[model samples]
Target: MLEEKFERLRNFLLAYFNQDMESPEGALQEYIEENSEGAISTTLAQINTFLHEDLTEQVKEQFIEDNCDLYFPALELTPVEWLKQVQAELKSTLG
Candidate 1:
């Protein structure tokens, strides 16, 4: 269940970043509001928790290695760090 949620969140972010969704930020805000009780920070914390605690190290590393470039450009940070940065950026942009 948690893995599915994380995948959904990741797909949302990818769509947002890739400009494949109209009003991606708005859509994400709506998603968070509906699914997470409008608590963006709490939702992000939950995502972070799932990333770090629920996934195995190898799985996490593979995911990061496979998709980091697609999401983050010209950055050498780990996947978790990139996620933190993206979350911060989104929060500021949405607010």
Candidate 2:
């Protein structure tokens, strides 16, 4: 269950980074409400760990390379920068 949630979070971030989301904040809020089990802190902590610790630099770079053709043309961010941006957005949105 945790792994599935983590995968969903990863996919959410991937879609966000790829600019495939029309309303990221709303979508994320819904997702949290649905999956957080009334513990937003635990959910956020798990997601933060996934974003900040589980996803290594090499994995991120490889993901970027593999999805190079799919990213938004105007997005000029490296993998680390993208992760940071996602983290910041998540924090701001949740708070």
Candidate 3:
């Protein structure tokens, strides 16, 4: 299911951030390998589109509320704002 895959990808990316946000291509590669069911480029494109276009603001807010503990203390952004940054990073990595 796309919904489950998206959540799994989100969780993986967030956990990856908890470790290192400076580099995400590695995480993206790992996720691709984990779900090696289709073309890697297609998977990446789908995820990029989902992060950049599909999710609604309300959904993003709820995601933040659900994962408050994942916040980085050094960043003053609210959870939703931080999530936007993460989304940008993931999109960049996809490219």
Error of 2 at 73 (Å): 6.9
Tens-place lDDT per residue, model 3, 20-46, is 544444554565556544444454554
What overall lDDT, based on C-alpha atoms, would model 2 receive against the true structure? 0.52
Q: Candidate 2: RMSD over Cα atoms?
A: 5.4
lDDT of 2 by residue, 19-74 (tens): 45455345455655565443545545655665555666776556544432334334
Best by lDDT: 1
Candidate 1, residues 26-50: lDDT per residue as tens digits?
5555555555435566656655665
Q: In candidate 1, residue 66 scores what lDDT?
A: 50
Candidate numbers sorted by lDDT from highest down: 1, 3, 2
Comparison by TM-score, 1 against 3, better one: 1
Greater lDDT among 1 and 2 belongs to 1
Supply the TM-score for candidate 2: 0.47
Off by over 4 Å in 1: 1-5, 19-39, 64-73, 88-95
Q: Against the true structure, candidate 1 has what lDDT?
A: 0.54
